[model samples]
Target chain A: MSALITCSHVDFGYENHDAVVDLSMEVEEGDYFCVVGVNGSGKSTLVKGLLGLLKPTAGTITVAEELKRTGIGYLPQQTRSQRDFPATVCEVVLSGALSRRGSRPFYSSAEKRMATSAMEKLGIQSLQNHCYRELSGGQQQRVLIARALCAARKMLILDEPITGLDPWAIQDFYGLIRHLNREEGVAIFMVTHDVANVVSQADKILHLQQKALFYGTPSEYEKSPQGRKFLGGGDLWE
Target chain B: MGVIMEMLSYPFLVRAFVGGILISICAALLGVSLVLKRYSMIGDGLSHVSFGALSVAVAAGWAPLFVSMPVVVLAAFFLLRITENGKVKSDAAIAMISASALATGIVATSLTTGMTTDVSSYMFGSILAMSPRDVKLSAMLSAVVLGLFVFCYNKIFAVTFDESFARAAGVNVSFYNILIAVLTAVTIVLGMRMMGAMLISSLIIFPTLTSMRVFKSFRGVVLSSGIVAAVCFCIGMTASYRFSTPAGASVVLVNLAAFSGFWAAEKGIQRKNKGERRL
Candidate 1:
């Protein structure tokens, strides 16, 4: 498969210090990639860099032309305001088509269909008219995933997607993501600290601590020192 | 009926109603995004900046709107920069700028205009203050604000809901944010002539909060807030005419009443739902 994104010695930082240094990685189409790191370990910085929200200070990070045009589907962590925001599921889901709408003032019929199909795929079509704030944790994640799908058909980048979810909800979320990645051929790039649970599902793993400590298949990651230390020790690095 | 006809008989009152209702609708439309984005205080800050600009215009013998419009718009942009840079907390920045502007306006007014009724009218707002020229200008600018809000409704909703996701989706998040700020600045400047600097922010905050108490969707809240604002403005103006009260204060009181009523009704519905679940 072709590489959807390639980062060559990328450095992301503020003025004084670099948050992510000399990071080299590649995300292939249909790859289920997991980036595991402790707090402030530059996982979010890397996500921002890949999403083009922040420019890399050092080397080049190239995105495939098609991926660049469609844009990476992004599921950012929920903010305090979003928890109480007054938006219907349909409204939130349809907003994902904003990039495709371009200069158009309203969504085209095709865009609306994309949103509807996204909701149906996530089994949220029934909840389309419901208030977003009233949904449970799993339902909310499903709505967000549907939104991400509307933005890009190729790849999704979720930052700490399972945070604040119950154990059952977490498993359901993983199942949904796995179905999207494996069954639908949609590439998954997930950043999380829940390495113990997510590592089993992820095809490839990148362990980061301001740099790449490990990058390989999950089996290779399990064998590596960094992954063993992180996964073996319960909440030690977290 | 007689009171309504008598109020409509006066030309100044008619202009006030036309300008006030249009401004109210514009404020409510923009207020949804602002209140959701936690930038509700922007209206208040920009109005203070407008007050300063008006005082400076008075000192320089320039038309108030002509001078205040550009100054308030610049202040809005400056406020956006300060908030985005994260060098200072947004609330602190707004408070500092607004307080300084208010002080500067007070000093400038004392030094030149000497507490004139024109200045007081801008501070407290008077129904008689809506001149034909002011009403015409307010109507034209309100149209622009409403048009832009409708044209960019989806983008505004996306940006307000999630800035990072919107940016990731190639939605030009910063551009839309700046657009929100500029539109809010214009709304504050236009409403200040009728709602006063001290109370104009209420026009941007109250209706949305009231609508949110009952409405569960963004579109619902936005539409409801517009209706709430227009109704409150009409009731407030009627009260002001009968009671000889300040127009700005009267409208604010009416909004406060609506907010309380909505809050109570929401609580009642929640209680009823819980009781039904218990059964």
Candidate 2:
């Protein structure tokens, strides 16, 4: 399979502050890549770079280029926003598919169908008419995931998707990710603080510390010195 | 009673009523988005800034509408840029603008001799003085805003809900944020004739507060708020005519009543639910 995204010697920052430097990595099609790092280690920065939200100060980046046509899906961390945004679950999900269409015309039924299907796949069809702000954390995450899916992307980038979820919800979320990876062939690049579970679920682990520390399979990561040191010298997940 | 009947039959009154409804519709829709974006205070701040623009426009002997539009629009753009950079919290920035604008407006009015003569009209509106031109201008402004809202609804929804998520999803959040601010400026600029400076914020806020208590969906909140605002505008217009009350104050009072009534009803429902669960 063709590589979906490639980041080469990328340096990124905000004004005078440097977040990430000399980072190079490639995400292959159908890869479930988990990026684990301590807080403020530029994990979110890497995700932003991958999504083209941040332009690198140096080096080159290449993405699938389908983003203009099929669009890229993104699920961000749970944000505590106003509870009355005046949108339904369906409307929110419909926004995901909006990237593929022009803003001048109304949404077609096909777009609505696509949004509905995406919500159904995430088991959030019952929330179609409900207010987005009223949903629980887990439900909101699912709705957001569904929204992302509506964009018809070959890849999904999630920033700390399971951070605020319950244990059960986290497990279910992982299961959904696995399903999306295996069935839809959508490449997954997730930034997570869940160090323990990353080893079992992620096909590859990219550890960041102002740079790319590790980029390899989970087994390779386990044998690496930095992974062993960071993973506490043993299998923390086990 | 005779004046009320005569006012109703007059073409200008019809224009005021229609213009009021149109303006309220746009305000109600934009209010939900503004509240959701957590920048409701921007409404108050920007309207105050428009007061400065109004004073300056009057002083320059230009049509206040034309002068205020460009000024307020520029101010809104400046505010959006400042807040979007994350250099300052939105509330703090709005407060800064509000204070400076209010002070400037007071000074500008003092400098302009005729400004003080009818200063009270600008504060609470002189709906009775509205001409057909004001009504047509308001209608056009309302239509443009509503059109923009519909055109950008999807991206706006994404940005309003989770801006970072929208950004990651390839939505230009800054552009959309600016769009929202500009829309808000337009609403404020048009609403000056109906709500005036002192009460404009109420027109943007009360409907959202009232409907948020009763509606669960975002769309529901927007639609319900629009309905509430339209109803209030109609009722207030009628009351103003019958009771010889101030139009702006009457509409604001009606909206406040609706907001408080909804607040009470929601509390009653919550209590009833708790009682049932305890039983």
lDDT of 2 by residue, B1-279 (tens): 776678779776787788888888888888877777767787888899988888777766889888988889898888777665674587787888888987787777788764464567777887765677777877887877777667776676677888887776667878877777887888888887667888888888889889988777666776788899999998888888788898999999999889989899889988998999999
Interface RMSD of each: 0.9, 2.1
**Candidate 1 off by > 4 Å:** A13-16, A65-70, A232-238, B116-119, B275-279
For all predicted structures, in order, the TM-scores are: 0.93, 0.89
Off by over 4 Å in 2: A13-18, A65-69, A82-86, A232-238, B1-4, B10-12, B59-62, B111-117, B264-279
Fnat computed for model 2: 0.69
Worst 10 residues of 2 chain A by lDDT: A78-87
Residue pairs with colliding backbones in model 1 are none
Top of the candidates by lDDT: 1
lDDT string, candidate 1, B1-279, tens digits: 788899999998999999899889888888888889878777788988988888778877898888898999999999888776774488888999999998898888888868788788878887876778877877887788777768888888998899988888778889888888888888788778788888999999999999999999998998899999999999999999999999999999999999999999999989999999999
Which run of 10 residues does model 1 chain B get worst, by summed lDDT?
B80-89
